[model samples]
Target: MKKILFSLFLLGCSASFAHAHMFWVNVFESDAHQPPHAMVSMGWGHTLPMDDILTDPNSARIGVEKLELYDPALKKTDLIKIKSKITEAEVTNEHFDIFPADLAAQKIALKKDSLPGVYQIGAISKATCYTHYIDNKGRYRIKHKSKDELDNIKEIKGSLKNQSFAKAYITLGKWTNPKPLGHKLEIIPLTDLSNVHVGDMVGVKVLFYGEPQSTSLKNNIYITAGSNTFGLDEGFNLQSFLVEGKAQFRVQSKGQWIINTMKGEDVTKDGKLKDLYGKVDTVYHTASLTFNVK
Candidate 1:
């Protein structure tokens, strides 16, 4: 049976793979055939990955609401807008056999330059959403179709905290600000972002609303690259708390690295980020940075 409302299933889609927020920045000029611009993307239902976005841009959450470019000095944040697309792929429907089983989202296109120093870019998406899900019995608890699956849905009610996501970082040659971009809860590098090496102890500090607040993060913080996630629920890979507000760790693998805080609070009543339905009194903040070691 064709889904009466295709979007209802979206709210309950599987997200067991998303360990952290990830945004990928691809320098277009890296390939001789590619342009000199940049493309940023995110992924959903999975850990947001850099390489995956290159092959499957549709893995994200459907929009590139904000893409900002910051120079080494952290002087300016230039906003760039990209397109959003929702796509469906035919994966497997052995159980839910009436609709497209796989879904993805993608966004693209931002400007890049030839500046030799370090640079920082951020990609963010926002949404006012409502969801209702019904779980089925046995064999992993599948979901069954319902006549009212698309109707009489209740709005998700809870805390009023909005959510913001960031992805990607890199330090090459010498000079990128690993400092916080002022997200509600952010991770900034006290260690130079532009000079990290394989064995270097890259210093980091957690800030809550622009103030140092690493003590609260305690065991709640996490770091990952590829499928490996460090701390709590697992084990602290190489992480150490230097003080109440700073933590330091080393990267083991090469390629791209992502540093992030676990779901944290966003306590700001600036009145700028109101929810679509009404006022959100509190918000959850997750920050991620993807950079390369090689």
Candidate 2:
């Protein structure tokens, strides 16, 4: 099946490039003048015109097929089979799948009834992809007859890849500034408990700098602490921190202890970041901590 699809893809390419952006797969025999290989070219639109905007061009994903067998027939058989342990082969699709990669959000406590307004984390944008898919009892149900039909795929088709997704738990209670747009936050350590014990806890007071005075957002700061990385954000706060996304951990291994934090995505270059008010040219978010091991 893979070889068939691959061959079809390669043939499609040379026959006269399918719609420019459509993904193409290639197939070739080992000893053949042109060995089996596939090349992917991303595009902004079907025509691949000069003005088709291209962002992050080199981001590529490749899928390869490798099969191993035991007590081989040694006849260079076209197909290889195994006894009982069945390993499912991976199926590749034309679309690109980019996941959140699990970002860890920390919870920071603030004065009760702080921002006075409620906030909901909803998708401000959707993932515009190439194809749509359905699911069967056990496998993916592709809408088209085969990969060939995908060349003519149209836009505004099916649900946006990651749209209509699960919403973030309502971090109710407002944001004087909806967008947490800012550059360069500060970190101030209140206590020198860098050499604390394993079971110690500390109190850290974080002061957000460049906070717009137009809104009472003094209480919008949230902090997450871990053994090695610490994370701080505005708006939502919770106890459980996500593992896959990096965060800060105040570690106390035996007699050696240290207080540090890890940065989340989007670190701006050296320049002033504009805020909603447009009054403050640069914004700096800071954290102060004091803890004692229990």
Candidate 3:
């Protein structure tokens, strides 16, 4: 087995990191074989590769609801049955104020006879609801329940439901155009993954519920990306607003890269939220994609 090393960095106190968390998937080529198989891992936090541990307020592990891999021929392999190796590590660097974290990872072997093309791996997280309000005692409290289920609250600060979707591409022998696997929110790459090089303009499209997200000042999609070597430095990475559901960025360097975006909707008055979870304020939808550039 090949060892995976993670470097921990101090998370910047930005507005995005102050209140938001992201989930993404990382695909690594295994070093244990000649034609390396793919190794999949889940990342949760603001930074790339690794950051804060994934857990609820009660310390319960938060895991993906679905994990699947698609072959070049579109054959699906369910990876939910594979037992993941969960590991934990404590961040004790005095230079950086951080907390302990956990990682869930697994290795998967690809089909030897599969077609030589791009393979896709995707994951979806279970939806969870949280409510922030002031209790009758004049104290602020955050509960992992809908406002309708909480009692004795003096003021309802906010409430929201969050879920995430992630996808990564790996090329075996040759490059092939990959199709979206029907994620609620997905990032589809218009540029070839296997042949991406520095100075190449890469294009991508953002889709919501299988429809293109039209560009608008109030609802335009925001896309961000960073290289594994540089890390995710606020205001220093690639940031762009999608135009008519499409965005493009120039490759700056050669290395592994991750691109991600998020969309939040005010669904407090929506009929769907009223029927599913009463008194919900917002619904957050996030998506990410990882690939390597030469």
Candidate 4:
């Protein structure tokens, strides 16, 4: 049993490593005579500015819990309820035990004439996965699908302890909100980005469970803009852990930006837990938000 379990996990690892998948909303100007709308796409890519990654058949089937279009101009928020298409097939990935893994939003209409102001839109998942896996020196990072390769596969039993949040920003015609959404782990803005420009500093706060994340160790927080990953600029990815629940940073570029927060939690209290592979389960959580600069 032990050998079979290990072999299955080994096969899983070789086939996939947890890839970086992010939720994002793409905005485009309505062709001359159409109502403005947006496409909520869950993209798979190496990092931020997911401009070049695959879309369409986009990704996932998780039901969207909250998809709100916050209009600062009118201080009115519209809730867009999305229907998730759950396939009859089961996907036994690191994230989904035996359920299908493909929930996402198609296109949706926005508030009419919602231009010339700063607008915030985001989607929270009502359906979350309790993923189980191992965490070993980043070697066993849960891959979307494990591959078949022989490398130093570091790992230990684990599960996901975080919820997924996808946020976005827009400037329809000059108004702003700049208020935090108070997510469990939120990377919300503290400054208005409706009319931001280059050389202008847009402030942001990182909150874990509604409070500040102590320390700004780059690792705990990853700020990325199109083509420019903050890790390369800062080097080492700020390996320190988020000591406090509060963290803050500023955007220094003009483009679509995605801020991702990752941290591990010790789930040892629940007592003796083991995965199918007979290893103790440890878990970590991740949260992300996106906005445009200028």
Candidate 5:
């Protein structure tokens, strides 16, 4: 009986060794359009409750949690956990902090060649590694920080691209993570323009980044119709707006402005926009673009 029990213990240890998978994580912005800026963080959503781990040992154990990815349909595609370690002597593209063996982990990549939809991407030693999370239903929520701005959409008629068409500049509002109370778990900034005329094209150009301030960072922007919104996405680096109609306007020169038609609203009124809903405040830097009609 003793010999049989010893053999079983050896077999279990072997299985554990064979199944030792590395744990890791990849940080991403809530919006897919925005690029990822990674930091070793913990907590739910965009709120990083802690700073990155410094001081490397011979080996490190890193655990990835609350990871998320977005699909083209603007949905929380997947979420998963990756826990692993890295030896202090691994070479790679960027000289990032390497977790000593058993401490280094990589972001999982989605494998669509066999299975579709977002899924957990496992890693193999000495092979290309990409880590992704599993798909969850209630992991994400819709976050809009500027509902008052979205209310300022006005009608306009002008010559955009040397052609006559109806136009308007509308704000669809910004979404924040860690959703605030009275906010849906998943919110899409898309606006309904089913009543618009056919052949009309809408353009959505977004600018997001931390602006240098005397004391803190802020999100700022300049727009058409002599409108400017500064410190709008305060403490956050993600911004998304939806405009379903085309607008015709050009920079007259410096501060001067001229619009071909006189039928639009200054969305940012009183130099301030209201925060809608988000549980966790974020800090970010990015610029992105999206153009669509719906």
Candidate 6:
């Protein structure tokens, strides 16, 4: 029995490590006739720009909990409500067929006749919990629940609650630097995103809970960046440790690019499990920022 439990623990670790998927938001200009509108879609998987479509079942596990748009003047709009009012005709795109038949994308209209500047779109995903354990039947099991909520479990291997935030910038007429949206885990661009070009160094700052993430030798945070052209080619990507919560990457190619980072903390160490959900052993916070380079 002890040997079986050890094997189950190893299996749990492997499963957790395999689930390194990232979520990001993609923005595209609408058709020529559909003025003042942009088509927004969610990207999920290990690739940039677009990857696996968010099917209904997987979407329920890690779907957008809230979506919002900020105009150039910093006027906030609840995109969820706007998406319901607008029809598919209002924001039709020639590339709409590229998405799956059951695509969960949205069409958002910009402020009518508003000044031309950078607009920000952000999405926050619902928190999801995964628990790995051995059941009373001596079978290893992974369930979307916390260890504390499981029944008839012989041994608990691990549990994690994950939440992700995705952000993208859309330039209408003129380009402007975007301000941080105050996500729990956020990536803020320090360089001008609109003027980015190949071979240019783009700098960004990572903040956790509105504070810069520490980069001490003992607690270094690393950020990874990839381009749509590479598509899951890790060797072609860039990874660097943050210094004072800031890092920079040189543009290797021109296309859609995504920068993302994740941080995990033990909930039990801080009594967060007892004080908060009481269902997770650890919690992970992930953030991604997507942009286009000329």
lDDT for each candidate structure: 0.44, 0.23, 0.70, 0.47, 0.22, 0.71
Candidate 3: C-alpha lDDT: 0.70
Best by TM-score: 3
| TM-score of each predicted structure versus truth | 0.56, 0.21, 0.80, 0.55, 0.18, 0.79
Q: Which candidate has the highest lDDT of all?
A: 6
lDDT of 6: 0.71
- For residues 27-130, what per-residue lDDT tens digits would candidate 1 score against the true structure? 21132333233334444323424323212222224345666766656666655454343333446465742223221222222234444455566665553222
Model 1 CA deviation exceeding 4 Å by range: 1-62, 75-80, 88-116, 127-162, 167-173, 176-179, 217-243, 265-282
Give model 4 RMSD, 1 decimal. Answer: 9.6
Pairs that collide in candidate 1 are: 58-105, 160-282, 161-282, 161-283, 162-283, 168-290, 169-290, 169-291, 170-291
Question: lDDT tens string, model 3, 73-109?
Answer: 8899877422323433345465854444444477767
Off by over 4 Å in 6: 1-19, 30-36, 55-60, 81-103, 231-236, 269-278
Residue 121 of candidate 1: its Cα lDDT? Answer: 66
Model 5 bad stretches (over 4 Å): 1-66, 71-75, 81-204, 207-294
In terms of lDDT, which candidate is stronger, 2 or 6?
6
Q: Write the per-residue lDDT of candidate 4 for residues 1-294, one digit (tens) a residue.
A: 433433443332222212344445544333344566556554324454442222223232234567676665436465545345444434456664443333333565656654555666666655333333344455324422222222345543333323456677655555565566656656676566555555655555667677766544343343333323444223222222344443344455656555566544444534432231222233334556665556
Model 5 scores a TM of 0.18
What order do candidates take by TM-score, descending? 3, 6, 1, 4, 2, 5
Residue 293, candidate 2: C-alpha displacement in angstroms: 9.1
For candidate 1, the per-residue lDDT at 269 reads 44
Model 3 bad stretches (over 4 Å): 1-19, 30-32, 56-62, 80-102, 234-236, 268-277
Alpha-carbon shift of residue 138 in model 1 (angstroms): 16
